[model samples]
Target: MNEENTFETHRPRLFGLSYRLLGSRSDAEDVVQDAWLRWQQADHASIRDPEAWLVTAATRLGIDRLRAARVQRGRYVGPWLPEPAEIDEAPGPDHHAERAEQVSLAFLAVLERLGPEERAAYLLKEAFDYEYAQIAPLLGQSEANCRQMVHRARERVQAARPRFEVEPERHRKLLERFMHAASRGDQTAITALLREDARLVSDGGGKALAVIRPLLGRERIARLFWAAYRRRDPAIEWRMGMVNGEPAILRYRTGKLAAVMVATTDGERIVELLNVANPDKLGAGVTPDPGRASW
Candidate 1:
């Protein structure tokens, strides 16, 4: 039997893989849909390994889209930001859902800094448990080169590992402090929360407003947040939402999201701040929820 339901069983893996590659919920959904479409078009009676085929198909689809995505992004208006990846890790989440959410958000976000091939290499080798030899043909690289790439990427990511892993509750508290600090212009509180070497990056995509360079230093970033909030309409609303499987704030003005901030906390302080203000990269047709904060 072709087993029509077989694909449904693998949907979680496919979704997690796609979301990690593209950093967008909608894009991941699209990638999985395209993979299923390929299955539908295949002759399928003798397909040897459906799981391998689906993974390969979805990975390549994401890469194809990513190439075009990069080109179009160069002409983007104010700042270019990755789409906020939201995941559900509430206490009652399904096992697959919780695991997939963590993989898609925190772990995947770390891969974003690498080149597409490096990112793919690291994800497949580390997360999906693919050996370098198996990963070689995916990018047309030799096994040895693939091994080297994975090795290099791992070193870089490992070097930046924080003092602790962020669980859901702790992650929420970190975001709360950050939003509160930013809202109240509390430099003292902000300093205690942000790492000494913490960096803040924002992508406005030119269509919206944001800071271009990674803001460094306590005073500079402190002023940065203070000014941003001061300029925001007092009536503007802020809601805490799950982004990248961690707690994040989605700032809205009127009905549109002005910013989506993701926080990565170290043992004692937040280490990285990625604020997305790019309208085009806000994950396709999904509307910014006015009631988003309740999450």
Candidate 2:
């Protein structure tokens, strides 16, 4: 196969690696585009493994972007959350249970706590199934050091991992009930669906109106949601769908995408709620008119 075709074959994998590393679709796309440019300029005849080379290049670029992103996020106006990306349910080589879990907002949130190198090491080893020996050269670190980084990253991630696994159907049911209560401004019903220590964070990117800080405790969160829906435009609509392998609610205002909401549950109740209202981050699967009433 020619170099262009070979690069096209591995584009999805490269984008996946970059997206997981940076947690931003725009940055991932830039990284993959830059990798393609590098691939074109290099002497492909001398390279033994094109896929590995492309992956390494994309990963390094993602790491660099992530490092710079941390500084920008620090100055962000409100609580920062990863942009929600729509998941394709079609049967594909990359569609699997493990990949779904790794791409989840809950998982990515935990990854954000780790340093850039640690995040890279963990994703390469756990998500992509890369060996320490293989990852060492990419990170320019000793195999032993890569192992240590993965170990540390794993421990930190495990510490914050979900306490219980809710079946997909049950999770959707719980979210629906929570949304129903919020839509009706039922504080009692909403509070019943939230864990006592539940937290709600909204990301408006300073362009939209949202909570400046995270709302803690079930009562406070319930009240916030109740008040929020009460103030929303009555013409707006809510649609339930999957985002990042989990159930989510998409809000539409005048047939335009307004916000995306995803929650992390502890089997019976929601422990965390993430509301993404940032216009810049609402690109995936969102159109001027979604057409359907609901998913």
Q: Which stretches of candidate 2 lie over 4 Å from their true place?
A: 87-99, 287-290, 293-295
lDDT of each: 0.71, 0.83
Number of colliding residue pairs in each model: 7, 0
Model 1, residue pairs in steric clash:
77-206, 78-205, 78-206, 79-205, 79-206, 85-244, 239-293
If scored against the real structure, what TM-score would every candidate get?
Answer: 0.81, 0.92
- Once model 1 is optimally superposed onto the true structure by TM-score, how far is the C-alpha of residue 226 displaced, in angstroms? 1.9
lDDT of 1 at 294: 40
Which residue pairs show collisions in model 2?
A: none
After superposing candidate 1, which stretches have Cα over 4 Å from the reference? 1-4, 77-79, 87-109, 160-163, 166-168, 283-295
